[model samples]
Target chain A: MLKANNKVLVTISAIVLFFLIAPLIMVIITAFGTDATIAFPIHGFTLHWFANVFAQPDFVAGFKMSLIIALAASLLALVIGVPLVYALTRYNVHHQAWFQTLFLSPTFIPEIVIGFALYQGLVITVQLPLLLTLLIGHFLLCLPYVVRLVTASMVLMDEHIEEAAWVYGSSRLKAFLTVTIPNIRASLVAAFMLCFINSFNNIPISLFLNGPDLSMLPTAILNYLQNNYDPTVSAISVLLMLFTAAMMLLVEKGLGLKALNEM
Target chain B: MKNRSAFLLLLPGVLAICLFLFFPLLQTIWPTLGGSGYSHFLHSGYNRNVLGRTLLIAVITTALALGLGLPLALWIARQKASVKSLLSVVILFPILTNAVVRNFTWIIILGKDGVLNKVLLGLHLTQHPVTLLYTNAAIVIGSVYLFLPIMVTSLIGSVDELNIEVEEAAAVLGAKPWTTLTKVIIPQLTTGILTGSILVFAGAMTAYTTPQLLGGNRHLVMSTLIYQQAMTLGDWNQASVVAVVLIIMTVIVMGLMRLVTRWLDRRPANA
Candidate 1:
C-alpha cells in the first residue's frame, strides 16, 4: 500500500511537470508548424516562420539591444556588487543586515513599480538618455542577484586563507584581489550568467523604459504580437528559448543550479 | 579596512539604488500627491474593480500554485539523487526563458483553436470552441504558469528537510495519510509556503507580459491599466497614482507574509 501511494505521488507530480512545460513544448512545435497563422492541427512542418523572424528589422535590433543591455548591466553589476558583498562580509559595517535587506529588497518589490518610477524619475526628472535609463533599471535588477550569489560563496570560504595572506604583508586590498576573488571565481561567473540572462529576458522594466527608437527583444516580440498573429513571434520565441536554455544548461553544469534555486 | 572605506565600498550600490530605484519611485508618486489621481483611485469603481480582480487572480494563482507545486515538491524531495537533479533542471526551465516567450506560449494554449480548446472539442467535452482567450481565466492560467516554478523551487529544500520519520510515526499511530500530510507535514512547510506565496502573489499582481498578451483591452488588470494610462493616454499622473496604490498593496502583502511566517515559526511552541 505504501509503495502504491508513492507510485501515485510520482505519477501526479510528473503530470504537473507535463502541464508546466506543455506551453513551452507547444511553442517549439508551433514554430515548426504552418506559417501565416496557427490552427489546431498543424499542417506540414516548415522553418519558413523561423526565417521570417530574422527578416524583420525590429526583431534584429531588439535582439542586439537586449544583448548589449544584458552584457552592460551584468558587467556593471559585478563591478559594483563584488565590492558591496566584500564590504558587508569582510568589514564591520553597522547594521550589515539592514544593508543586505535594502539591496535584496528590489527582488521583493514589484518590477512594475520599478519601471513606473524609472519612467517618471529618470526620463522626466533626471533627463537621462533612453539607453542609459534602461541600463540603469537593469543594473538595479541585477545588483541584488549578484550580491546574493557572491555572498553565498563568501560564507563558505575559510577566513584563515585571507588572514594568512594578510600576515604575509599583503594589504587588505591585495589579499582580497589575490586570495579571496580567485577562490570565489565560480560564484562570480555564475552570478554574471544569472544577471545577464535575467536582464536579457526582463519585460516589466523594459516595457516602461523602451522608447520608440529603442526596444528590447521581449518588448519587440510583444509589439509584433500586438500587430500580427502570425507564428513568426512563435519562431523568434523558440530561438530565444534555445539561447536561454543553452545558457541555463551551462549554469546548471558549472554552478549546479544552486544560484538559481536560492532566488 | 577602515569603517569609512567600507562605507565607501558600499556607496556605489547605495548610489545606484538611490539614483535609479528610490529616487525614481518617489518621483513617480510625487506628481500624483497634488492631483485628482488619489481621489480617482478612491472613488473610481472601475479602478477599484480592476484592483479587486488583480487581487482575485493573484489569490487563485497562489492557491493553484501551492496545490500543484506542493505535490511536485513532495515528489522531487522523495526522488533519488540522479532523478532529483534532472527533475530539478526541468522544473526550473520555464523561469529561465523570456517572459514574452512564456506568455506567447500561453496565448497559443488559450487561443480559440488553440491547444486546450482543440482537446476539449476533440474529447467532446465541449460542442463548440469555448472562448478561453482574452479572458480573466486566461490571465489566471498564465499567472499560475509564471509563478508555479518559483513556488516549487522554494518548497523543495524545506520539504526535503522534513523528517519522514515523524510522518511514518503518524502513519503508524493510526493517522490517515491525509491526516499525516495535514497534521505533520504541512505545519513544518509554513516557511517555504509563506515565502513562495508572497513571491507568487506579488509577482502575479504585478505581472506584465502574461496579462498584456492574454488579458487584452476587454480585461484590464492593474498593471495593464497603468500601461494604458501612461503609455496610451499619456496620463502620467493617473499612472503614478495607480503605481502608488499597487506599491501600497504589495507592501501590505509582504508585511502580512512576514507576520504569518513569524506566527508559524512561533506556533509550534505553544502547541
Candidate 2:
C-alpha cells in the first residue's frame, strides 16, 4: 500500500513539475526561433535574439542601471539591517517588538501604494532625484528580509560564545566582529543575495519612480511587452531567470541552500 | 555610555524606516485631514466602492488559495523526502517567475481563441469559444495560481512539524481518521493557519499586476484607483487620501490578526 501511494505521489509531482517548467522552456525556445512571431515547434533556430539583446543599447543600459540599483539597495539594507539585528539580539531595547513590527509594515503595504506615496513624498516634499527615491523604495522592501534572516541566525546561535569572547576582555565591537559575524556569515550572505534579487526584480516602484533616463530591466521588459508582444520579451525573461539561478547557485556555494530554505 | 552605543547601533535603521515608510504614511494622513486646508477628499462615493471591491477580491482569493493548497499540502506532507523536495521546487517555480509574466501566460491561455477555448471546441464540449478574459473570474483564477504556492508551503511547514504519535494514539483509542484530524492535528496548526491567512490576505489586498492585466480597465481596486488618481489623472491630493485610507485599513487588519494570535496563544491547552 505504501509503495502504491508513493508511486501515485511521484506521478502527481511529475505532472506539477512539467506544468511549472513548460512556460520557461517554451520561452527559451521561442527566444531562439528565427520567426518574428512566437510559435511552438519552431521552424528554425539561431542565436539572433541573443545578439539582438546584446546589440540593443536600451537593453544594455537598462541592465546596467538595474544592476547598480540592486547592488546599492542591497548593500544599504545590509548596512542598516545588521546593526538592528545585533541590537535586537544583544540588548533589551525599549519597545523592541514595536520596532520589529514597524520595520516589517512596509512589506504588508501594497507595492503600488508604496510607489505612489514615495512619488508624492519625493516630488512634492523632499524634491529628491528619481534614482534616490527608487533606492529608498527598494531598500525599504528588502529591509525586512535582511532583518528576519539575521535575527533568525542570532536566535539559533549559542549566547555563551559571545559571552566567552567578552570574558576574554574583548571590546564589544571586537567581540561582535570575531564572534557573532563569523557565526552568522552564512545568513548574512543569503540575506544579501535575496535582497539583490528582489531589488532587481522590483517593478511597481521602478514604474512610478523611473524618469526618462532611468529605466530598470523589469520596467523595460514591461514596456516592450505592452507595446510589442514579441519574442524579445521572452529573451529578456530567459536571461533574467538564468542570471537569478546563477546568482542563487553562487550563494549556495558560499553558504548553503539549506540556510535559504530555512528562511 | 553603554546605552548610547546601543542606541547608536539602532539609529540608522530606525531613521531609514521612519523617513521612508512611516513618514510617508504620516504625510499621507495629513493631506487627507485637510492639512493644506483642502477637504476635497471628504466624499466617500468612489472610495467606498474601491475598498469594497478590494476586500471582496481578497477574501475570495484567500478562500480559493486555502481550498486548493490545504489538500495538496496534506498529501505532500505524507510523502517521502525526495518526493517532497521535488514537489516543493515544482510548486515554487511560479512564485519565482515574474508576476507580470505569469499573468500574461494566463492571458494567452484565456484569450478568446486561446488554448482552453481551442481544446473545448475541438472536443465538442462547447460550440463556441468562451469569453474568459477581462472578467472577475479570470482575476480570481490568476490570483489563486499565484498565491497557492505560499499557502501550500506554510501548511506543509506546520504539518511537517506536528508530532504524528498523538494522532496515532488517538486512532488507537478508537478515534476515526476524520476525528483524529479534527481533534488531534488541527488545533496544533492554529498558529500556522493564522500566519498563513494573514500573509495571504495582505498579498491579495495589495495585488496589482494580476488584477490590472486580467480584470481590464472596467475593474478598479484601491491600488489601481490610487495609481489612476496619481499617475493618470495627476491628482496627488486624491491619491494621497486613497493611499492613506488603504494603509489605515491594512494596519487595522494586521492589528486584528495580532490580537487573535495573542488570544489563541493565551487559551488553555486542553480547551
Candidate 3:
C-alpha cells in the first residue's frame, strides 16, 4: 500500500511538472525551429525568429514603453508605498481599517473593473495623457502589494529596535533611516520587483488603457496575435519568459523565494 | 511625530489610490446606476446565457483545480523540505511569467498538431491530431493552467499547517490511506479547499487574455463578452452592464463560498 502511494505521488509530481514546464519547452523549441509552422521534431534550427523579435517595430516600441512604465510605476510605488507602511505600522491612526482598505482595495477588486474604471475616469473624464495615466493606474494596481510586503517585513522585526534607537539618542526619522530601513532592505527590493512584474505583465489594465497611439508590450503582443499568428509571437514569448525568469533569479539571490510567496 | 511628517508620508500614496483606484471605480459604477443598462442586460436572454456559461466555466475550473490540487498538495506534504521548496517552484511558473506568455503556451500544447497530439499520434494512440484548440476544452485547460497555481498555493499553505500525527494515528488504528483521506484529511482541508476554489472561480470567470488567446470564439467568458460589447460593438453601456453583472456574480459566489466554509467549519463538532 505504501509503495502504491509512493508511485501515485511520483506520477502526480511528474504530470504536474510536465504541465508547468512543457509549454515553455514548446515555445523555446518553436522559437528556434526553422519552420514558420510550429510542429514537433524540428528538421532544421535557426536564429531568425530571435532576430525577427528585434526587427519588428511594434515589438521594439512596445518593449521600450513597457520597460518605461514598469520602471516608473515600481519606483513610484516604492516611494509612495514605503512611507505609508511606516505610518500605518508605527504611527497611531484613526480609522485604521479604513486606511488599510483604501490602500489594499485595488487588489481585492477585479482587474477588469479597475481597468474599466480608470478608462472612464482618467481618459474620458480627467483627460490625462496616456503615459501619465497608465503610470498612475499601474501605481495604484501595485501599491497594495508593496504595502503588504513592506509591512510584513516591519512586523517581522523586533519592535523595540526602533524604540531602542530613540533611547540611544536617535530621532524617529533618524532611527528609521538608519536602523529600520536597512533591516527591511530585502523586503524593499522584493516589493519593487513585485510591483515591477505586476506593472510589466499587466494586461487587463493595459487592455483598457492602451490607446491607438500607445501600447504596452503585452497589449501589443495581444493585438498582434489578434490579426496574425506566427512563430514571431513564440519568439517574443520565449524572450519574455526568459527575462522574467532572470528577474526572479535576481530577486531569489537578493531576498529568496519566500518573498514571492507573500504575493 | 504623528502630526506632520507621517501624515505627509502617507498622504501621497493614500491620495493616489483614492484618486486613481477608488474614484474611478465609482465613476464606472455611477453610469450603471440608472436601470436602463441593467434592464438591457437583465432582460436579454443572450446575456443571461452568457452569465450562466461564465458561472459554469468558473465552477468547472474550480472543480478541475480542486481535483488536481488536492493530490499534489498531499504529495508535497509528504516530501522532504528541500524537495518541497523546489517542487513549489514548478507551480509558480504560471505567475512568474506574463499571463499572455503563459496562455501562448496553450497554443503549442493544445493546438491542432500540437505537442500532445503529436505525441499521441506517434504513440499510435490515434490516427489524426485531435482538434483541441478553439474549443471550450481548450479554454478550460488554459484556465486550469492559469489558476492551478492559486489552488496549489492555498493548499500548500494549509497543508503545511496540517497535523501529520492525525494521519499516523489513523494508520495505527487500521484506517486505510484512502479511508483516512476522505474521513480525516479532506475534512480538515476546509480552509484550503475554500480559499482555492473561490480564487480559482473568480480568476477563471474574469480571465480575459487566456480565453481570448486559447478560447477564440468558441467560448465567451464574462470578461471577453465585456471586452467585445465595449470594444467591438462600441457599446459602453452594454459593456458596463456586463461588467457590473460580472462583479455582482463574483461577489455572490464569494459570499456563497464563505457560507460553505462556515458550514464546513461547523461540521466536525456535530460529527
User: Which of the numbered candidates is closest to the native, going by highest lDDT?
Assistant: 1
DockQ in order:
0.68, 0.42, 0.60
Order of candidate numbers by TM-score, starting with the best? 1, 3, 2
* Pairs that clash in candidate 2: none
Which segments of candidate 1 are over 4 A away from where they belong? A1-8, B262-271
In order, the first chain's TM-score in every candidate is 0.94, 0.94, 0.94
Scored against the native two-chain complex, candidate 2 gets a DockQ of: 0.42
DockQ of 1: 0.68
Model 3's i-RMS, to one decimal, reads 2.5
lDDT of each: 0.86, 0.76, 0.82
Tens-digit lDDT string for candidate 2 (A1-263): 11214454446545544544665676667677787865544568777777777876767888899899889999999999999889888888888898888777777677878888787776568898888989999998889989999999999999899999999999889999999899998889888888887788777777688778888877776666667755676677778777866775686578755555554
Q: What TM-scores do the predictions have?
A: 0.95, 0.90, 0.93
lDDT tens per residue, model 3, B1-271 = 5667768988997788778877887777888896588887878888887787777778788998888888888888778889877877767756878898888888877878787898899899999889889888788888888888889888988877777788788888988767887888887777888888888988888888888998787578788888888888998877877877777777787678768887877877536
Tell me the spans in candidate 2 whose CA falls farther than 4 Å from its real position. A1-35, A40-47, B35-47, B169-184
Better of 1 and 2 by TM-score: 1
Query: Any residue pairs clashing in model 1, and if so which?
Result: none
List, residue by residue over A9-56, the lDDT tens digit for candidate 3: 668766876776777787788777777776656658888888988998
Collision count for each candidate, in order: 0, 0, 0
For every model in order, the fraction of real contacts preserved is: 0.76, 0.30, 0.64
Q: Worst lDDT window (10 residues) for model 1 chain A? A: A1-10
